[model samples]
Target: MTGIRAALARRWPTIVIFMLLGPVLFMLFDMAFEQMSQDPGLTLARLGNWIAEDVFFVPRFVFMLGALPAAVVGALVAWRDSRGLASGRWIGGLSAGFGIVIGIFFARNLFIFTPPPLGAQLAIGARAFVSVVLAGFLCYGLSRPFARPLLSQEER
Candidate 1:
């Protein structure tokens, strides 16, 4: 208990930041995917309606249960990336979100409706995990060239 309190006392700011950041990150991921799914090209104007629609939907409400944790993981990725490199957080968050989506997809395929062969689940899990790793690296690489130039001199 003392240890917990001490940790919290030292880390409360981080805790609070994450509590605020998590929902915003989740909403951004949700909006980006929803927008892309709705149209392959730009649809910025439609976002207002989509956000309003999203909040009222029951399925989305249920999915938020899963997404919040995933978004927090994304937030962690973003936070880590921010520490090391500028502009990495955007793509890092996207990659991490994609990783979470891959995980959810695998779970649904392997266990949600019907159990698959043990070998199949193992194979899929290995592939999905590798994909997640590669995606992060790829996104990080993509962001590297863009990071420095995008920042102001003060930020750099």
Candidate 2:
């Protein structure tokens, strides 16, 4: 469709960045999974013991390595969209962060078998949601200084 093509044309840089980074992100996740699978029993034992302390590491890594870079790329795209005057940085960052988190959830579901118990699953889901939201907010805060209102263009 023309509409889709137009949108892609307008946002090609962001799309290209995502496309380039996606495989690397997936590979990192696969490596993490492979490491866990290699010693499932020991990993499980360690996880059980450290659930309260380190259970958030994976989500944090996803936010930092996966979402943050994507958000920065998106912010750059937004800056370009604003004709180099305003960034719209928070909007881009939040959208990218949320998108990455959703993608991660979907990928986990698709690739991972042997589901954990319901309670554990629920806890993990909740943690991921919270972590993503927090990361989004952090990105928003970090971006605010760079972003300007689009309406300012007309005012100038």
Model 2 TM-score is 0.38
lDDT per residue as tens, model 2, 1-156: 565455445555554444345433443333344345455633645544543465446534543565555545554554455454444454556545665565457445633468767665554454444444444444444444434443654497
Error of 1 at 97 (Å): 10
The stretch of ten residues in a row with the least summed lDDT in candidate 2 is 22-31
Cα lDDT over the full model 2: 0.48
Cα-based TM-score, every candidate = 0.40, 0.38
Whose TM-score is greatest here?
A: 1
Per-residue lDDT of candidate 1, residues 3-77 (tens digit): 545434433443334334434443444455445645464376676666667654633553455355544543444
Clashing pairs in 2: none
User: What's the alpha carbon RMSD for model 2?
Assistant: 10.3
TM-score of 1: 0.40
RMSD of 1: 9.5
